[model samples]
Target chain A: MKMLINVPESVVPDALRGMAAAHPELAVDPDSRLVVRGDAPVAGKVALVSGGGSGHEPLHGGFVGRGMLDAACPGEIFTSPVPDQMARAAAAVDSGEGVLFVVKNYTGDVLNFDMAAELAEDEGLRVAKVLVQDDVAVTDSTFTAGRRGTGATLFVEKIAGALAEEGAPLERVEAVARQVSEASRSFGAALSPCTTPAKGSPTFDLPAGELELGIGIHGEPGRERRPMMTSGEIADFAVDAVLEDLRPDAPVLALVNGMGATPLIELYGFCAEVHRVLAERRVPVARTLVGNYVTSLDMAGASVTLCQADEELLRLWDAPVATPGLRWGL
Target chain B: MKMLINVPESVVPDALRGMAAAHPELAVDPDSRLVVRGDAPVAGKVALVSGGGSGHEPLHGGFVGRGMLDAACPGEIFTSPVPDQMARAAAAVDSGEGVLFVVKNYTGDVLNFDMAAELAEDEGLRVAKVLVQDDVAVTDSTFTAGRRGTGATLFVEKIAGALAEEGAPLERVEAVARQVSEASRSFGAALSPCTTPAKGSPTFDLPAGELELGIGIHGEPGRERRPMMTSGEIADFAVDAVLEDLRPDAPVLALVNGMGATPLIELYGFCAEVHRVLAERRVPVARTLVGNYVTSLDMAGASVTLCQADEELLRLWDAPVATPGLRWGL
Candidate 1:
């Protein structure tokens, strides 16, 4: 692997140490693999906690800060965190209000977060759970039992975190989180496969002139593999798949996300094509984000996600958010 | 070349269109290839203008917003913009306080910006220039007559832009820009070559299991090529090179920047090693940034930049700035 890591086993801990050092506002516990806001568990506010694997960074850990996730429990690369980590994080971030678990739709993540929630309840902590299954890529990929949660995890965290920052009750926050997840859909394409450090080789082989459509973030088999196509054609395919599962009447917030190794310029190009396709269908875009918000290790690809947005959700998304990965309106 | 672009020729304009659409706060002029603050020409503040090739997204264009460059003129990918674009940008953004040009050290860039400054002077606009030559990679590269400006261009624009935002005179702003350039040094590595869109192939050849150290941002040959080394050894080499040119007595602002295709997880791992080496040397880190701020398109590698920071520079760095690429303290 050409990755810049000390050792495959130590990548997560070392990265966490660096993250903690970079952002003083974050309190990172390497022992437990939990990242939380230094001033978390704010009184009378619902706390948001989310996590998955380590490879898709800036997702759960980088989103832990003011007006976003209150805490995150990161696992090893492409592996779900254990229940102990989640339970500890919940206990740490749960104020009198409650704690909301933003679990992605992978089997391991769902099981672990469920166990953690039960443990937290046993400890007299109010816990609510929202499962995000926004990916339209496949239903039951390698590590997932249902449609895999992808970019909408970020949307749910930002919107629900905004509602929580308003001192909303736990049920209200959970409802908003569910609403965001239900309103969203994502589809990804990969021109190249990413190598997992431990694996020491690419998870899959992508010949130089071929591409995979609807690939999962963990290098799971996609809907189809075809000879490489132009970016415009690929954008059309991804956007069409996402739009198929989306409601056309409501204006949407679009996220053109890079799956790791794609450059920003390419993302911008893909985003422009996405907007063009949406415009042709007369879909009003409420907001648009283009970057590597969610990613597979170093896969060269992009994903298109569309979330039907209402004024409330838009307000929540536009609300001040200060995190290491996504920061705006502070 | 595997890239997500529409047409090679239209990449610059198409990317700019997407940028303007994504960020309504910035004014984008496709006709002149300029990105400026939506509400520019602030009555009394010095206007900051910087630009170069278009491939470096968020460097010049994405940095055009509050507390950064008032205007950016992007040319074709990895090609210096013509004088007309810069002249028009300067005239558009210049307020009564005058304008300052932040030019990177490349023959084409310096010559074009100099011509543009002369043209602006003919129009009765006060202007000053600061040339950045902070890349410790090589004293001269293929496209540059001296040490090529790389990551430090961002530092110069940010710190100098902060001074200009505070209504500093043009000469003072230029002085600070030069100071930042002088105090900073950068070195990069590339595991693979970047293909220019027009070229339709990799800029250079690199055999598998090898890496280029001290590479220029534009795919220029580095100081040496060697077998691929572990991330720790690479970090040591890059940090040592940067520190050789950087004074250890002062607290330094460190930037571990990815060259487009490097993943955030790997960047964090590399950053951790950088901090470890700096700590061993007892070099205090005043501030640190880890991300793809400056990039070579789709190149899978990273660069390390260190700027010796004084109180003024730190204050400017800490000041609130809201641009699409870098946003914090706002």
Candidate 2:
């Protein structure tokens, strides 16, 4: 598979070990498949936990720190973590205030987090779950029932985590997470397919001169394939798809995210077009983050996520955050 | 080219435009092709300026901010910025203390920055130049004389910029820059070749299951190509290449950088092996950064840089940095 891994079997644990080595501030438990804030379980503070697959790096795991996710349970690549992992993460991070699980709206993530929430509740910990279904690409997909959560997961985690860091109640944190989720939409376009370590081949067939629109992070069947388009054209289509679904009345915090292998130079070029399209539609951008935050492993593509932001959400977003995936204003 | 760019001709300017839009904190001059700190000409602070080809992103431009670079001049892809751009950037950021030109050791960059220094001197500005040539991959490469500059540009900019931020004179900044450069060594290995937009094809043919070692950032001929190796095996070779030259006794600040297209998951896995190798060799790491900081556009590979860190260098490295590419303690 031409990947820089020892083997397909140990990819997840090896990466977790790497994460542990790089960021000693985080308590990385390779055995539990958990990444938790070093000083998690802050007394009486709401704890935020999220996870899904391993490939979308810096998403759930990279977001764990001072003002983002309290803990993350990463699964094997493109697979969901079991309920045991999530339950253990909840137990590790939950304080008297309770735990808020930020579940992406994939079927496996939803089901597993739901079971974990019950497990946490059974253990006498207050648990609340918020599902992020911001991907407007599909209502049902290869591994999802409703909309597949994508970029807005970042928005939800950052804003909600900000509130939680302020010692907000678990219910408030969950509500804020839901608010951000409902207020955001994402669309992705892939120029190449991602090849998982286990699979060792591209999950899908995307010819060199063609591209897929509305593609899922895991290379799931997208809206359609077409001849490759220019950056501006891709921006036009992706932003239109998001804007049509978002129809925002307020300004947005724009995320022009790279899907794994897309370079920053290209991300910047694509982000300029995204800004141009948003400007043409008279949508005010409250803030913008451009990088590989939510990514598919080594997929050459980009995704645009827009979250309608109010003053409170903007304040929450601008709040200090220190995490491997996203960090700012700290 | 199946790139997220409008056209090869406009890629640099468009990406600059994107940089401006995304980071309002930086004064990005698209026409002049300069990215300067938003608050440039900071009284008597030594102005740090660096730039080279546009492909290695977040290198010079993305490092412009409060604690790193004062200005950067991005050239066309894999091409050095003209003397005029560097001269103008010096004019924009110099506040009488002096200007320090941070030049990579590529032939074009060294020549252009040398000319730029002369121009700045003629404009009644004192300018000192520091050339980074810390790559141990080859004594000389296709575009370089002596050692090729690679990951240590980041170290030179950062440690030197931290000193510059404290209003150090040009000479001291230049001295520290040279120190960091001399103390650091880097080695890169590539799984796949990078394709420039203008080329629209892989720069070189790297057959499947084969990889190139000691590759220049522009896919210049490396030491050799061999059958693919595991991340640990690659780390063993790359770290040996670096440590053989550096032989650091003090704790080192390690930068495990991705060559554009390598995913974070792999980078982390690779990082774990880097730490293991360093530990085995009894080399202590003062700090570590893992990501695509200095990149060759969309190359599926990575580079390892180790800078022998003394107290002063570690303090400077720990100093606040708020650039787009690297940020902490701000």
Best by lDDT: 2
The list of candidate 1 runs beyond 4 A from truth reads none
DockQ for each numbered candidate: 0.67, 0.80
Candidate 1, pairs of clashing residues = A330-B330
In order, candidate lDDTs are: 0.89, 0.93
Quote fnat for model 2.
0.78
The CAPRI-style docking tier of model 1 reads: medium
| Model 1 Cα lDDT, one tens digit per residue, A126-187 | 99999999999788889888899999999999999999999999999999999999999999
Query: Highest TM-score, which number?
Result: 2
lDDT per residue for candidate 2 within B204-248, as digits (tens), equals: 999998999999899998999999999999999999999889899
RMSD value for candidate 1? 1.3
Query: By DockQ, who's the top model here?
Result: 2
lDDT of model 1 at position A39: 95
